[model samples]
Target: MSAAVHSERPALLVTAADLAPQALALLRDFDVVYAGKSPSDDDIARLCKTHNPEAIIVRYGKIGAQAMDAAPALRVISKHGSGTDTIDKVAAQARHIEVRAAVGANAAAVAEQALALLLACAKSVPHLNTRMHAGHWDKASHKSVELAGRTIGLVGLGAIGQRFARMALAMDMRVLGYDPYARDVPPGIEVVNDLDTVWREADAISLHCPLTEDNRGLINRDTLARCKRGVIVVNTARGGLIDEAALLDAIQSGQVSSAGLDSFADEPMAGGHPFQGHERIVLSPHIGGVTSDAYVKMGVASTENVLAVLRA
Candidate 1:
């Protein structure tokens, strides 16, 4: 007997960089259109129009109303990571498009990255290593700070923030978490709804909150002024959460001792961004959730989310 005739698979647009093969395997029945890494909203709109995809998987960059309008048949939008600010949920919801994120998929990885940055800042890892490589023993000049007795303030107490809090607690540090929307605070973390409390109490501050209009300049000069002198800062959240100019000024003025940054307001941080050549800053190219394991977990979750929506 002749084999059953196969039908053309529905199309899925993916914008992440070098998506995991396993994810594509999970989506074996779908025709995927991969936009290059960091595709603009306009790029998304254009791609959606050209491909006529039923769903879109955003790895990075914003998916706005324009992109949503471009795909008349678009049924769902999925994020590879937990953050949904990059996607215009209101616009998606207005048109009856469901939005899903790979929640908890990259939480551990992102938490680990935040901790790594915190440790690097506390111990002055980058500065020491750079000086050591330059043939300077500089140990006496740059002493490492101990994490055991310090207080860490977390701006968000979601999965990633909670994971990081546990790690910090294991190191004998005190954790203060500020999440206005969280239902319960994790064990060993002191929950504070007031932003001032976290800002005033923490020796080290790490941002894990989503970017929103209200919290965009959460860590500006005025906020930094409230923090302890020489307080270490780490951000694994959206870069726009902190005001760049204010952060730079604070760093220069010694209000902020050091910073560990993974996200930035303008990514691919242009040639003359102020953070460059700063000895006290540890900058990463936005790879907090880009670890190998996280990629697979996020990928699988993203693909499954799309399929769930499309098939439902």
Candidate 2:
């Protein structure tokens, strides 16, 4: 086959295997080449040799110095989601290649998913479903709590956290928030001064903070120890924020009632993963922002970010 032509508009290499067509349609002016599946680092380098795209969009997998070295002609990287942790920023900076993250585009969808997990965990939907499937009708024996009178503590008061607080208030749940960077907590949500304050006060705690070296594993055993005995935890944010082993141990010991995890430290968690058999945990295949609306928004936003850099 002839190599993908490098046109005047630009050639874009979409490294992600599952980018929606709508995202591609938005960038139709450019030549779009998709990797049949997620390409390995060497495969990406080989593709760069042939296609010579001006921009590359990556999702989920890491983009390291080796990948960058292979595509010196590449000017931009359009990250599909809010997180840029997987992209090698140091290499991009040194190479003078612009990198763009589609931040805030999927906050609403992700925050909504977090709340869904909290409610599902509290109501024991998975357990009830399993019972019904097993030829047992024990609905009457299972007790479920309502969110109306309970308290929800938000870990980060960023866009997603603030959005969650609004939803919680509408449900008549008390919302408490802790964010050192936030200027003021949203109206109707109580602003707490420290991380422990949220843990001690909340019946369900949702984490919405960014993952950084300092904040890695912030929700470890010690933090979980301070929470209410039956506190439901939701983390739609980055995976490194919670210590997976510590969380599993807490769940087994009944220190943590249940958890809703959208992101994991490792994606496509290996077969026979511990969480596979856990009924209490609500595990999404990182589909928090997998909605149609979020996909279009992120694509358009990243497109803009890319165009801005080229213009500059």
Candidate 3:
């Protein structure tokens, strides 16, 4: 832990203000640099130029080609969570740098968040709470949707999606899943070959897939139009999956009953964004995987991924 010894060690850059103590303890041999929260591409590039780190742990910002080029010694970019959409994979590949994700590290946390959002939307939790706070009880007139016999369509059957499916099944709800790459899906989930089947048959739809160019804006006007009327939508995965404008239109037209969104197409969704004041849309500032337990798990997983490549 001496300054001289730390200076002699290889550097590792973490794109976050702090990491879990458990993860930090594992990096005792490295000189770790902390990039303050909300670092931009230029800030990360500047840090890379200064530190010349052997590895980078992506937590809060996008890592571009410039940042990768700035660090000639960079061999790996490890994601602190499951999503790697923020990392420039093409640039990493071209530079012969490896990109790894702490897959399933935050599965439980994210799955729980998805469930919370789904339930909130189904039962009108937020709207009811607002009415209660304002002393305008309309309990006699208000009706909540029950979930026991409902069918929920899940997109992406990864660890997080599977976990949420189990929870939904426990509630006696039918589950329909659509994932082209998923194999050996758990029992009780009816796997559908196409998205059209999911949209047509499901009463509610939840997204749990990664953001990719092929699937960007997957839930758009056309897809929403195919869905059953008054269908509930919940997105706990990537923001780019849903077209915000189309979703707002669907909500306004009553084609979609309600929405629970954790991630947005743009991070730190600017003030006065269109989705801000909607009563039926519940929003969280992309904190689905930010629980204390998941934070420690992700940090440890990301650190281990870094060490794996560095020690290879």
Candidate 4:
């Protein structure tokens, strides 16, 4: 609830309170609502009913049709990150609300995180650390492979994937990509039309693809079976790209040697997930795009989009 005196300003609702000061300063002219940690969909709907926000800044939360129904004044939904899976696009379109994303703002951060995950999986960093913490130091048992001579396959060569390609190339790794619409790929990477070749050839495969109805579970049992035996998997993209159940089975059978995942299909993964406590898997909360620099850039872009739509 607001404690300050009232003034004439546009109502703006931010679904997260962790927005940087740079982004907050941009919203000085607007009456803002900040959803604290562990926010819920019910909170969003309740806030809209209480304050009637004309614009919403969505940062990693599920906002449904109920929230839209509560806020009849809402004109636009601006996502702080690139993905739109959290927001209900079909419902928003039905309500005639403009939904947009802060694209490319967090590309570098996400790309860097992707490489970190890939390296961590290849070196078994998490496993070694866990063993050491448990007072067991068997150094020679865990073998680390050199990344220089191996082939790395990228599912999508968008902004983040392009950056990952550069990093891999710097380490002398051969990078292959599969993106049907990307016309101008970077100089070093080879973009291929055939998807099977990536699964068959890549020593390690990283996913940078978006999640869609047609592409959901793109890495299912059939696709995982097609991969080279003992292949490593990395995903810094949306979770829906890989079927968690299928991946778990592959890992158990040694079909997939290791995995580094930052996103999952049913997110905010509950305790005792299939990947957790596994020596071959490294997991992170979906925070690849949570850097300070990305926050400011995304926040400013989202605010700008909101303002543009409102002022028009």
Q: For each candidate, C-alpha RMSD in Å?
A: 4.0, 2.3, 2.1, 2.0
> What lDDT does the true structure give each of the candidates?
0.88, 0.82, 0.94, 0.88
Angstrom error of the Cα, residue 218, model 2: value is: 1.3
Instruction: Give stretches of model 4 more than 4 Å off.
Output: 1-7, 134-139
Give the clashing pairs for model 3.
none
Off by over 4 Å in 3: 1-6
Clashes (candidate 3): 0
Give the alpha carbon lDDT tens digit for every residue of 1-312 in model 3. Answer: 112124678999889899999999999999889888888888888888887899999999899999999999999999999999999999899999999999999999999999999999999999999989999988799998899999999999999999999999999999999999998899999999999999999999999999999999999999999999999999999999999999999999999999999999989999999999899999999999999999999999999999999899
| TM-score against native, each model | 0.95, 0.91, 0.98, 0.93
Question: Considering every candidate listed, which one attains the maximal TM-score?
Answer: 3
- The lDDT, on a scale of 0 to 1, for candidate 2 is 0.82
lDDT of 2 by residue, 1-312 (tens): 225675677667777655666666667677777765656777776667777777888764577787778777789987887888778888989998888988788888888898888888988888888888899988677788788989999988888889899999999999999888887666998998888889898999898887888999999999999989988989998899999999998899888889989889887778888988898788888788878889888777777777677668
- Clash counts for all predictions: 0, 0, 0, 0
For residue 214, give model 4's deviation from the true position in Å: 1.1
Please give the range of 10 consecutive residues that has the lowest summed lDDT in model 3: 1-10
For residue 223, give model 4's deviation from the true position in Å: 0.2
Q: What root-mean-square deviation over C-alphas does model 4 reach? A: 2.0
Better of 3 and 4 by lDDT: 3
